[model samples]
Target: MHDELPVQESGPTASGSSPASAPGSTPAPRNPGRADQLDRRGGLDRLGWSVLRPAPVVCLTLVAAVIATGFAVRSSTAEMGILIWIDAHHTPALDGVAWALSWAFESPRAIAVVVLLAAGVAWRCRHLIDGLCAGIALALTWGTSYLVKLLVGRHRPAWTLLRHHVGGPEQDPSFPSGHATFTTALVVVVVMCTRRGWRVWIGAVGCVLAAGVAASRLYLGVHYPSDVAAGIVYGAAAGYLMVRATTLVSHARPDRRAGQDEDELRSGPGEIS
Candidate 1:
């Protein structure tokens, strides 16, 4: 009689359950689907991407510094008096220039136009993310400043505190200067939005315009120096956030370890050699 080879009976293992793990061998990955999802998202959790990608730590640090500075400015009597004195000493030519800069650079209509134009340029260059990032920065910065205004409820400088007023009265809370924030945002957006010619020129022009807008708020005696400072810092932070957030979302560099784990799971355990 020929020797018969033993037949292995799979029993319950026939239903496709994995073999039970022996003590402390690295357990097989329980969720290949989740691993795949993570791989698709560059193998990072949301918080991991938010903190690790695009120098988020630096951006966060800048934001913290600005917040601290805002608190310090709010409490300094000397700082308050300095701006007040500057307001009292404004000249007609300077006032006109300031008002013009504010209206030309940061008016609602002007902002809309700039964003739309930036979008057009970015689309033409096949880099739509830049445009989207710019829009987010502008909207986020403006919204945050507006919310702070409402929370602080700091009124505009008393009309009597200055030489005189020319424009229509602002009838809203004014702790942070909306013009300052938006103008700075505009500058950053212009610098970042497209790889077109004249970007440097546009950025330079934007910086001058932003500076002028900040000065105009002081010259018009409508916003405190602290308000302008806070607006500038907030705008910078918003731009930094926009750039990093966009990068974090768009990046898809595969993680070597995650890819390996996923591959191993998909291939299943190797047969004993």
Candidate 2:
């Protein structure tokens, strides 16, 4: 009789107790979600794609173009034809235009402009990845230009002028201009690295400057017309490769930890890594 009474009373006793008053009972708090992990992972994936995937394409394309241009240069008839074309096409009006535009590729002047432009890009990108990309572009332009100039051993139009005037040294192996290469590289780098809306306009202007420089090389007559042509191709290829490489290199590095902590923290938990 007592057992039956206690069992019947147990239900009512438990039902009357509030959670806080209950023994061995507590509320469960919510947990952080997979959103954080997903954001981080996505960033890493993009980086990997940029670096690992595009590299082979850039390298192979460059190699092919080099071989092809070299073959084209081997044709004497074609080379003579181009020379005739340049010589006949030259006029006072054209010379004036070329001279005016040539100032952009003037070595020390261009270098200063390039440095300032790079600094501005770095400042604006300010993010760790963006800044690194800009830096790499600048380094590639300066370093690769130097390396190519040494290896190619091409002479400038300025050298030929010296022979005629008895003031300048003999023209070096006049092929593949250093000026065009560096300028083209700068153009490609800036265009690729920028996120600005008017970046295309900026890049187009860079192209014009590079073309003007190349034209100047030919007009001065130290370099064969072919030399400037080759330089344009070489510089353009280098720029394309390096800029792509920068993108790849920048993106490839995974942000496992906080990068630019302020940016990361500001991004918040729901934001991308």
Candidate 3:
């Protein structure tokens, strides 16, 4: 979201002081107090403020919980159980639909497209920070997914042995589904960048899209439920962190109006006129 600063016209004031002082006149001194305050608020404080919001806190907690659960259950038995159940009920129609959905969101291209669209919207709205955050989030999601896959070293579901096998062979590790991660990250960026009035609609659509991508992974017998779940958690966390980073950087900029607003927020109610 963009915040408009009020425009100030240069002219004589009520006291008749010229708007432009003489070239030899001493320049107004910098506000030492403001400088001190800015110095005190280091990068850590900015980051803390960015992530201290309620929504981010909730999302971060969920991410931690999901990661913990994944660690606790090292085996894919739980994943296999769900996959088997889904396999038992699979139909040709479902397979066709899942295949189409899965094919549509394969890897970096679909992820890049979503990020680009979100960035385009943000740029159109004159919210450069939002656009940057979207791009950062997608980049982080992709990189993190690859790193985690390497660390976890989990194999993709062995669909060839199954009677209802429809999915093609996948070479990547399967602890976290990249498609799910990318789609979820995109959804998070879209939800955060959208205006309040249209946020609900955007969020709803994003949720459905994310869910469809996740489900497609399962229906295609390529990813286990746990993989998709972990991916979602990773993606959401990445998006949240990137958004927070953008906010922190924006606030930390040398903007007079922004500083005044921050000071007002910090001041007691009695201090406000």
Candidate 4:
């Protein structure tokens, strides 16, 4: 008869957990319910994406329209009327929100924070070119607004004209609001960095936030309507150009796209990292 061999236990280990459940021993199971929901939502969003496939053209057309509208109202000071209306309707709650939005994205500091965040995103995707492109694009967008402010040399709206004032004096030229420009430009970069399934949700929310910031400027009695409008137009155009530039770079370097696609596929639905 063969010698009796040792009979190792086939059940839970001494730790009282199954051997297969040991740390790093087996892959964690996916949440089927959540995964299915994401899949369905992602499918629906893709149809919308398909409709907006010519996004660059659409964006340019809109920018032109905004520019025309800005010119139409530049002389009328109708934007001042908007500020007056907002001032008339100010509630304590809205005042708090407006103050928060106005202070949240201050320039230079805001630019630095966003650039670092963009670089971090690229690092997470393991794509160096994307990080560089996003940083440069954001810098250019901010700088463009600054230079325009100097060129336009427009003064801030009169505090006296606004019966109720909220914030301190704004020293910079009031044309092309810095806050509005920064917020708009930042949204574009954020939407670009995220996954396709997440882009629509993020972009829509970001647009709403950008609009809020723009309105806050008018509410605070600092900016003319034309200033914020031009900021939005420039921000969107600069952002669209940045996206196109990044796409061209990615196409030129197929290896980057392949690596990113691989990482994206490995991650579960709606996962950022």
Alpha-carbon lDDT, every model: 0.59, 0.52, 0.65, 0.66
Q: Write down the worst ten-residue block by lDDT for model 2.
A: 4-13
Decreasing lDDT order of the candidates: 4, 3, 1, 2
How would you encode candidate 3's per-residue C-alpha lDDT over 44-141 as one tens digit per residue?
11222334557667866876675565555545555677788788889889899898878887765676685676568555545454456457666776
lDDT of 1 at 49: 37
Clashing pairs in 1: none
Model 3: pairs clashing at backbone N, Cα or C within 3 Å:
none
Query: Model 1, which residues run further than 4 Å from truth?
Result: 1-55, 71-80, 105-107, 127-130, 196-201, 250-273
> How many residue pairs clash in all the candidates, one count each?
0, 1, 0, 0
Candidate 2, 141-189: lDDT as tens digits:
5566555445555444433223222123334444456666667777766
Q: Candidate 3, which segments miss by more than 4 Å at Cα?
A: 1-58, 127-129, 250-273
Show pairs that collide, candidate 2: 47-251
**By TM-score, who's the top model here?**
3
lDDT of 1 by residue, 9-118 (tens): 32125444554554555545443332233233221113223345665566668666755665555544445566678767777888788778766655577568657855
lDDT at 118, model 4: 63
Error of 4 at 158 (Å): 1.4
* Stretches of model 2 off by over 4 angstroms after superposition: 1-59, 67-93, 127-132, 152-170, 247-273
Q: In candidate 4, what are the lDDT values of residues 141-164, reduced to their tens digit?
A: 777668767766777877787777
| Location of the lowest summed lDDT over 10 successive residues in candidate 4 | 41-50
